[model samples]
Target: MTSELIAALRARLGDERVSTAESVREQHSHGEGHHAPSMPAAVVFAQSTDDVAQTLALCNAHRVPLAAFGAGTSLEGHVNPPEGGISLDLSRMTELLSVNPQDMDCRVQAGITRQALNQILRDTGLFFPVDPGGEATIGGMCATRASGTAAVRYGTIRENVLGLTAVLADGRVMRTGGRVRKSATGYDLTHLLIGSEGTLGVITEIQLRLHPIPETIAAAVVQFETLSDAVATAIDILQFGVPIGRLELLDEVQMDASIRYSGLTGLRALPTLFLEFVGGPEAVREQIAVVEAIVSDRGGLGFDWHTDPDQRAALWRARHHAYWACLAYRPGYSAMTTDAIVPISVLAELVAGVKEDIAESGLTAPIVGHVGDGNFHTIILVPPTPEGLAQAWALDRKIVRRALALGGSCSGEHGIGLGKREFMADEHDPVALEVMRGFKKTMDPNGILNPGKML
Candidate 1:
């Protein structure tokens, strides 16, 4: 049956486009997370919407599970197929279909990466602001409903995505929404697929709302004597309506790793806030003044603001490389990153408790977060031993349970691909989970689309 499936895919997509090669299968077997890799029976590169529809049709007919692959950067194991079948490679379908400058929106194939789209829009003074700190394809971002530091001011993928084109489980082509800003119409199906994690269907194209380049952008890095002080400052800034473009937090350990790895100097190895304010020069200055007062009241160190474009880029460049820096702290160890979010009022409590837990566990975990919105991550590095794995998983679950107890989510940006499936029941009501399963059954009755993920 496996051989028959491979032959059928090769016949339709051409031999070069479909492959059963061991190396190719291995490449599509996992994402960036720590989930165990499972090789697919075959990998098919879909270069167009028609190509995706045809592949889905064949998979549906054969009752073979199908998983979509983009840049393979999902940290929740969204692209991995625990049950072996066809891995639909969509990175080749990258095309900027149309750009409506007047409407501040654009259309593109799912395979286009966020950086690629922003680069294409540079000349037009518009950019796609969803930066997940990796070379993540837009389709994968939509699939997981990803966000980044910019999410605080701009918003996550859920808000930026205007519409999408997808291929349903049974091979029928589907399109939802349009350039119109909002619709009061029936069931918002576009949103249903945005964060579905590809269990319902394969997203082929996306129409994204864009933001204009800020007239004056300034970045600042400030340190705090204590983690509580740093988090309090972040909370206060937001409460006061600072309108900062980005607000990030890095614990002392992460700051040390980042400083050493990124070759940055003069930053004290302490709990810190990396902030960016956007607007006209005067407006940015006023926001900075307001933020400085809040930070000072919370015992934050003096702000070091960067106005030069090169300096500002250098600051964020070091931040975007944070995960790599944290991993470098312990060579030959795997990092199982955890994502947890809480209300701003409880973020300080959560971070403080998690830090003490990591120290008590004797783990080398560096923390970083988009603290403006009360979302944070911990890169827990552990050796490749049974005991090490056990310790890491336990620490991860501890943090997750604490977040849920504090009216938070097990995941903020990372979707429940395989890692957080167990916590779905804990994080959501049983009825919510059942309704989701019902939706899955309705869309892909055969359970041939990305099985063993989400539900």
Candidate 2:
């Protein structure tokens, strides 16, 4: 049967695009998640929307599970193919279809990465702002509804995506929404696929909204004596309407890990907030003054700001590398990062409680967050042992439950992929869960599209 399916794919796409090689199959079998390894039987390198449609048609007819492969950077095993079918990789489909500068939008193939798109638009004075820390494909980012530090001001992929072209489970090619924004039209199928994790359909092309490059930008690192103080300062800054472009918090443990991993620093390992302001020169200066005053009043130490592009990139690169730094703190161990978001008023209390929980559990987890949006993540390093893994999973569940109880979500940017499926019923009411299941069934009756994913 496997040979028959491979033969069909080869017939449709030719020998150059289809492969049954062990290395290629293994490469497409798993993503950067803690899930156990599982390899697919074959891999297909798709080069166009027609290629994706044809591949899905063949997989559907054969009753073989099909999974879309992006950059394989998903943290929740969203791209892992456990059923040993075919991995439809879109990496070869990287292409910029069109750029409409006047409309402030662009059409791109699903495999285009955020960094790649930004580099392509460097001379256009427009850029996409949804950064999910690691460089991820636009399709995968949209599938996960990913956001990052800049999401506080720029919003997530859910907000920036204007429209999409997707292949439904039955091999039907459909387009949702259009170049003109703001539609009150019927069901929002466009958004339905944004966080579906490729269960309902496979995205082939995307129309994304872009923002004008800011005229002036500045970043600052403000250190605090306590985690509570840092959170409190963040809340105050947001409440004062300071127009901060990015406001991130890093606890002492995270600071220590970062400094040790990056080396060469005179900085103390205290709780810190990395912030950025973007606007005109006068407006940015005003916002900076307000932020400085708030942090100083909250017992913050020397507040340093950078305006140079290289210096700004260096600071953010260090910030984006926090996950790696935390993992390095414990050699021979992987990380399971949990994300949650709460109201700004309750952020300080929740963070303080998390600190207590980590201390009581005796776990080596550091805290970091996009504080302006009241979203935070705890990067926990777990040794490759049954006991350690069990303990880490337990702590993660406890944190999610706590977040739910406090009117927060189990995940802020990371979607509910393989890891958080069980928590969906608890997070959303049973009625809402049923609605999601209904949508899943309506779109994918056979359940061949990324089976075992969300819902």
Candidate 3:
């Protein structure tokens, strides 16, 4: 049966596009996460929507599980196929389909990475703002509802995506929403698939809303004596309506790790806030003035702002390479990061409690966050052993439970892949989960589309 499936795929897409090689299977087996990798029987590099459609049709008929894979940068196991069937690779379907400058939107094949799309739009006086750090494909971002540094101002993929073309499990095609901004459409199916994480269907093309390049932009780094002071300043910025483009927080431990790894200069290893302000020059100045005052009031070190693009990038290098920095800081250890977000009113207290938890657990977990949005992550460091894995998960669960107790969620941006699947029942309403499973069953009844995930 495996040989038959491979032959059928090769006949349709040619042997160049179909692979049964051990190396190719290894590449498609998992995403960049802690989950154990599971190799598929075959990897099919899909080149077009028709290719995806035909492949799904054949797989559906054969009752073979199909997992859609893009750039394998997903933090959760979104690309992992634990059931082990066919891995549908979409990295080749990367053509820019259309762009409507008047509407500030563009259409591209799902495999286009955010960095590549922004480069393509560099001369268009507009840019895509969903920067989830790594070179994640837009399709994967849509699948996981990803957000990053710019989320405080530009919003997440859920808000920026205008529409998409998807292939259902039975090889049927459906187009949702369009170039026009607002529509009283039926059911809002566009959003329904945004964060489905490949359980419902495979996204092939995306229509994304773009933002104008900021006329003036500046970034600042403010050091705080304590975690409370740093978090309090972030909360004040949110409440003051400062329209910050990006607001990030890093605890002392993360700061130290990042500083050494990224070769950061002159910055102390203290809890700090990285803030970006964007607007007209005068407006940016006013925003900075307000934030500086807030930081001062909170007993923070003076706000040191940088306007040069290179300098701004340098200042943010530590935050961007945080994971690698943490690994370097603790040799022979792996870190399992947790995504816990809570209300702003309770963020300070929650962070203080997390510090206590980490200290009591005797673990070296560094903290970082998109504090403007009440979201934070902690990387629990442990040896790369079975006992270490168990310890990491235990602490992760404790942090998640604490966040939930404060009316927060177990995951803020990372979707419920293999890591957080068990927490879904606690994070959402039971009826909501029921409706979601119903949607999955209605869309992919045979359970061949990325089976054993998100439900």
Judge candidate 3 at residue 396 and give its lDDT.
88
In TM-score terms, candidate 1 sits at 0.99
| Candidate with maximal lDDT | 1
lDDT tens digits, residues 1-455, model 3?
66687888899989999999999999999887888999999999998999999999888888999899999888778889998889999999898999889889999999999889989999999999988867889999999999988899999999998889999999999999998778896899899999999999999999999989999999999998999999999999999999999999999999999999999888889999999999999999999999999999999988799799999888776688898899999999987788899999999989999998998888899998789889988988877888877877788889999999999998889888888898899877899999998999899999999998877
Candidate 2 lDDT over 8-71, as tens digits, reads 9999999989988888877887787788768888889999999999998888888899989889
Off by over 4 Å in 1: none
Span of 10 residues, lowest total lDDT, candidate 3? 1-10
Error of 1 at 46 (Å): 0.6
Clashing pairs in 2: none
lDDT of each: 0.92, 0.89, 0.90
Candidate with better lDDT, 1 vs 2 = 1
TM-score of the candidate numbered 3? 0.98
Q: What TM-score, computed on C-alpha atoms, does each candidate reach?
A: 0.99, 0.98, 0.98
lDDT of 1 by residue, 213-246 (tens): 9999999999999999999899999999889999
